[model samples]
Target: MLKPLPDTVKGPAMRLQHMVMTFRSALVDRLVAHDPALSRVRMGARVTLSILISIAALIAFHFLVTPLPSISYALAIVLSIEGGVAVRDRTPGEQLKTRLIGCAASLFCISLAALLEGYRLVADLAFLGVILAASLARVYGQRGFAVGMFAFISYFMGAYLKPTFAELPLAALGPLFAVTIGHLVRTFLFPEDWRRDLRAALKAMQGRVMDILVRLSVLSKEGRVTENDRTELRHMEEQLKDVVLMAEGLLPRQVDGTAHSDDDPVTALSMAIFDLHLSAESAIVQSLETPPPFVLVHAVISGDRDLAEKVAASTAVEKGGETARASAQALLWLQRSLQALGRAAGKEAGGLASIDDRVVDEPPTKPDFSWKNPLVRAAAQITIAAGIAMIFGLFLSRERWFWAVLTAFLTFNNTKSRGDAAIRAMQRSVGTALGIIIGLAAATLLAGHTVSTVILASACVFLAFYFLQVSYALLSFFVTIVLCLVYGLIGQLTLDVLLLRVEETMIGAVAGTFVAFVVFPASTRSNVDLALARWYDALGQLLDAARDGESRYRVIELSSRLDAAYRELTVAARPLGSAWSLVTRPGPIRQTLAMFLATSYWARIFAHDFAEAKKPLDPDVLTAIEEARAALSKAAARGSDCFATRKPRPVMAGNAAPAFRQGAAMGADRVANLLNRLYPA
Candidate 1:
């Protein structure tokens, strides 16, 4: 061997490797926490790659054939990005059809806008009509939504670029090229495979379960579970719940040549995972004096069945106090679940006999045009906001007025309430502000280097799309940088131009926020109440099914609905954590959030116990459930208090198993106490 490396070099190399590993671990944790399946990450990459390839193709075409307008290139990039996003969860044929429609709509809008360029007053009036029509088109479902977006963007591009009649034909090529490139990339490079995705999700869930088990094992061995450990365990439990829900959502409703039963292997795997999680939580909270079966933990992690059985069988002996006994019981259940999980995983690996693979078209339904319709309300809100933004933006800078309108329209894209709109607007402004500082420095440093500028812009596009789901602020920041690079390339880069962008962004945000609060405002409280009503309804059905000993399929279906409803309620109640909501209605908002959380937690535990127990409810427990259901129905109907006048007494039955009794009693007691706290006499 050659001479050994010096300590100086080796030390730094080791440190660098350690740093890299730490960073990678942190990034993985964050992504898994936010999106366990990594679906968003994949979509972002697909869109970014499509845009980059489209840009490269345009550059090559420009040199090889007749020169193309800069606006044409910009339009092509935008269409490509939108097409990538629109094709998700669709069949190849549907993707192609959507792309074709988007292209046609874009071409028509571009030509119309170009033809109307000289007529300022009529053009402005037509713009408002376009906004109204685009919003209304959402009644047609996803296709209509895509068409509306393409039409609006194409028209905005036409007005902003002000293409002449002679350039219209060449400009029309943008959407065509974009459609072709986007379809090719989506079909060939990133085709959707439901089977592969489901399997990967299952694997990810298993890995996360193992990680939690490892942590719990270490804590058990130490004989001291700290508060921090419990909190961390709770967080892990929530993340695992998200992953399980996602996996279940991906399960095929009907497999070919096989009865679509709820007793599928994947369903079994999910229940096993949930059971293990429940056991882990119990052990952690009780602080097990006896360490977990080390050999069994190793066996599960290593997939060694023989050792697992030996350890699991040896741990059947009861030991220590009540807490220790509880912990031992949890460990015994965990072992059985792990064995069941292994069997399910093995069966799933063999794959379904015949997947249906058929894409059923949803029948067309009548469009709801009433004022109460969400689509109608959204369109009206965005149209009003855009109108206000356009007026103010014209005063600020007539040529760049579309920027403000774009911001205002996008602020309400997915937002439902005034609080959401305000938060989105605030994020956009803050993102733009930070972007300006970074953009200035970047622009100055990369000046006089066209190649470097192009590369930097492409990088920014990738980063912007990657963070689209993770953080709106990050997306906005990268998008602003991309705009800065574009301006630089067009010989229009200046401090004044960047500053004007900031001013326009703020104006647009304020306009959107104002419209959200003033015109047909959707309050956060109302949204939360609606979500709560839905969740309560689902929960009531699930309780009835479990108590009445309905079919397993019915219980599973109702449980899935309950999970979905809880997710919606979570989203709706998010605004309660905002400083504005807390400051405005501190007591009620805080109490409502606490009650929602407490109810969800206990309800989940109760559902899990009943699902596993598979026994008819005791009479006392049935009566308690019926009382709880009636109380919940009244609370949902009233949209507020149900226990203001009198509270129901807690019920505990001795006939049920200890676990079932505990779950039922605790769930009822927690709900009653939290509701009283929320709506005290």
Candidate 2:
């Protein structure tokens, strides 16, 4: 008889179970945290397209070959191709690289699986399980690599398991047809012209500068831009970046042999956009100077010719007079370049005239590149995965081991923490178990009727399609259940056969998942900590630039800090179980660090606004600047301490200013809004 669980043992087991559950919940929360904007829509579309094509291809495969052994191989090829590259809004050529890398890595994984049959204790079933588990662990923290490896292993498993040569072809062909159809659908829906939107975005960036100039003029004259205006400008800048990335995604890669085709308008437009971007950089470098070229343009727009002329003649940026003439020349060249590009592309140009043409020699400072550490970890994970797969195949039956190995490889990505991997393992185990049970039940209920079997298959299709977008695990559940039942219907459906299939599936899934969790656990704490450290560094830079009156550096620094903080915060938020629990959860000090980083950025922006208010050297303005500087110093110190303590800190207040002078005050408020969202306290 089985002994009852001891209270002492049960308590720890239950806690383990609780921790696993909460961890899974956390990851799901983070995945949906970024308001699901374009990503959500794209994922939905992709899943729907994939499922639709998979169904149609399966039907064709059933009719085309009498005893298909080529099917699995074909499916593997298609899935591998699909997995190879993912094009984002930034770089289409990058997609080609991803595809090449993914394919090569997958092929290597498959070869390793084939070689694993030599290992002790890894013979037959266990070998496959170990191989798959190891491959999946490698991809736990990354995206495309895992998927590519999954397709490769899964295809090999299906191909090896076939008793008949005909069945082997059928398995490969089914998936291959599915992916080909999906690719065709995607090509038809998102055409190249979507890239034209990038050119429009570039034009809009110029317009934003002009718009900011107008606001600055009003604020300088009356003292401060409104909070709403600042927020809108920030939003516009974000949109501009998004659009640029999107266009870049649509452009053909040099590898595709279509990078700059004769008919491509995007290439020329992209070139022009890059030039204007340089101009924007130049304008930012001049932002610290009183009566800078942009300021002169603003003054002219406001009907202050005297102020404009006076400001135009002065030639210093950051250091004073030696660089003044160069800065003016740079501004003038920027104006001409903007007009030329705008006229060539039929796009509107703004803020270009304010740039001094001769200022081209001043190079902008570059931001730090600490974001690349995660990639090194990802590479190591993949190498380990290949080794594990080879060892497992050595111990298990080559055929059965393939199935187990493939299942393991799909379990996690390169960036996932060990806790996150544990959560995923549990989900995979449960989902697979349930699918097998349901598959057996469906086979029994619909016994021996062709129409009923077909109907059951169709129902499975609908459910898989419906839930695939919601969650991949759930999608896998239906896909597995339906596949088992349908395969049974075609192969001599019997109660014994159905039960055996279910049992085998559960055995494979569990073995695969367990190995993945145990082999090499991922750790989120370290990654989050690293991100927080970078954020602090960025925060320090922003504060230093503000103190030195380096407006361009401050703005550039602000963007980098925001992006890093958002990326890190997103990673932290996605893996937790409950939204409320994220704030209360212990061990993630990065969350607190992220909050303070945001606060520091806001305080610096406020100080910049206060400095801007002292135009033409009013003694009162310098006094105000000194006061804001002290406030900023305290805020930065508090931010640094909060990261060290992992404790929540109070947010600092904005600079004191009357309602009339609130024009530039709006810029400070916009930063404050972003900070509030980040820290909430």
Residues 1-681, candidate 2: write the lDDT tens digits: 223444555577786776676677776544433211334434445544555456545656557745444434344433532432232223334444444454444444334444543543433344334344434433333334444444454435533542233343345354445445544544555322332443444455555545545544454455334656445544544444443344334333343232243233444454454444444434333332322445765654454556655665664343546345444434544454466556646531222222222111223333222335443343344334434544454354433444344444444442355444444545555666677678777877777776887667656654664454355567567766776676676675555544444444344445444444454434444444455556545654554554455543233434444445645555553554333222344343445534444454344444434433444434443343354445444444443233334334433222212222242344344343433333234
- By summed lDDT, the worst window of 10 consecutive residues in model 1 runs over 648-657
Error of 1 at 555 (Å): 0.9
lDDT of 1 by residue, 222-282 (tens): 7576767766866776777677777766666543322245566545655665555455445
lDDT of each: 0.71, 0.45
Q: Give me the runs in candidate 2 sitting further than 4 Å from their true place.
A: 1-67, 73-151, 158-180, 190-404, 434-472, 488-522, 544-564, 573-681
Poorest 10 consecutive residues by lDDT, candidate 2: 353-362
- Backbone clashes per model, in order? 0, 97
lDDT of 1 at 478: 90
> Which pairs of residues clash in candidate 1, taking residues 3 or more apart in a chain or in different chains?
none
Q: Give the Cα-based TM-score of candidate 1 against the true structure.
A: 0.87
Off by over 4 Å in 1: 1-36, 87-89, 255-259, 266-270, 273-319, 358-363, 582-591, 614-618, 640-681
